[model samples]
Target: MPKFLIVGATKFEIQPLLTYFKIPVHSPEGLFSTESGPDISALITGVGMVNTAFALGRYSHNLFDYIINAGVCGAINKDLKIGEIVNVTNDTLSEMGAEDDSEFIKYPDLNLPGTNYYENQVQIISSALNGLRKVSGITVNTVHGNEQSIAKVRRLYEADVETMEGAAFFRGCSRLSENYFQLRAVSNYVEKRDKSKWQMPLAIENLNSFLISLIEELEK
Candidate 1:
């Protein structure tokens, strides 16, 4: 059976899947069998890149056949409605380079020490992922809440979504496995701070729902 690792920034974000697999909250890390599907495990890496990197380091990557980074994200495109799930096919650390007064220079232009952007190398993990919108995303140290910064990022990356951990998760996976991908549900638009407009609950619910479907497809 294909062993899988489901990585999330927090347990609540992935609670539905954990419950679906009948995997308890505290012991989702080790290999488990559900009596009907492949062996699976999960990791609740705390928020942000640093925590994710460190959390991933605690495990042996060689044991899993697939790794899926799951979370909620802010949409850059107005068309991507709240609670809609999308596959982040590519991601980059948006703040990895310095600002040249007015124009921002990317890592490639600055000749950085390590890669700043990554594309999904994993071809297929589950057929359930085939029909979702494939989108480009940018990872940020601070989520955009200002109009000026949001516009600048829109012009710079042309990204469909923004998240705190996607790129870091991608980078970590680059060294750990070749069979991994990220999936995110839109929680809100990348606009000024407006907690009233955010739909975090819906995003989490939708994200876990899709993950459950994906796991079912993997069982077949």
Candidate 2:
């Protein structure tokens, strides 16, 4: 069986899923016991862009066959409410490139030397999430947006949601292997970090259920 590498942004995002898999809580860095999980390996790769990239690059150094970046994100579109899963179709850094005199130097699909550029893996991931309701494919990056920025990203990328780690995960996975996918769930709206409005708990529950089903399917 091909090994699947499950990457979560934090333990909060992965706790429920870990329970479903019967994976014992070993350490903060996610060193799982073979007696706990059968086939899957989970890693809690901190949060945000830089940490996520570093974790991916470090662990994916010919260590794993398949990589799945799963976590909670914020909804950019009002229609996509809380506790919804969003598979990443494509991603771009919201703070990449350069700032010149007046214009931001946006690099378009340029695969520099050995750096892996963006690619679409949504269809494959969505296929796995076929019957799972309230799931979407999103375009995510590091920076959360204001109204104007959200509007611009939605217009340009047609993304249903946004996040901080998807782009970096994509870049890292692309550099490592081709059999990787990104799965995200919405915990709050894009406006602000309102804990009262966040559905993190519910999202984790749904994410856990989703992961269990996916694992069963993979086993079959």
> What is candidate 2's local distance difference test score?
0.67
lDDT of 2 by residue, 1-220 (tens): 6576788878778887677676777677644533544577787777777778888777765465567888888776678768877666666565555556855554453434443236655344435666543333343444554667666556655555667777787877777766787777778888744578788888888777787678666655
What does candidate 1 score on TM?
0.91
C-alpha displacement of 189 in model 2, angstroms?
A: 1.6
Candidate-wise lDDT, in order: 0.85, 0.67
Indicate the worst ten consecutive residues by lDDT in candidate 1.
28-37
Per-model TM-score versus the true fold? 0.91, 0.80
lDDT of 1 by residue, 27-90 (tens): 5333333454458778888888888878787775456777899999999989998999999999
Clashes of each: 0, 0
Which candidate number has the best TM-score?
A: 1
The alpha-carbon deviation from the true structure for residue 46 of candidate 1, after best TM-score superposition, in angstroms, is: 0.3
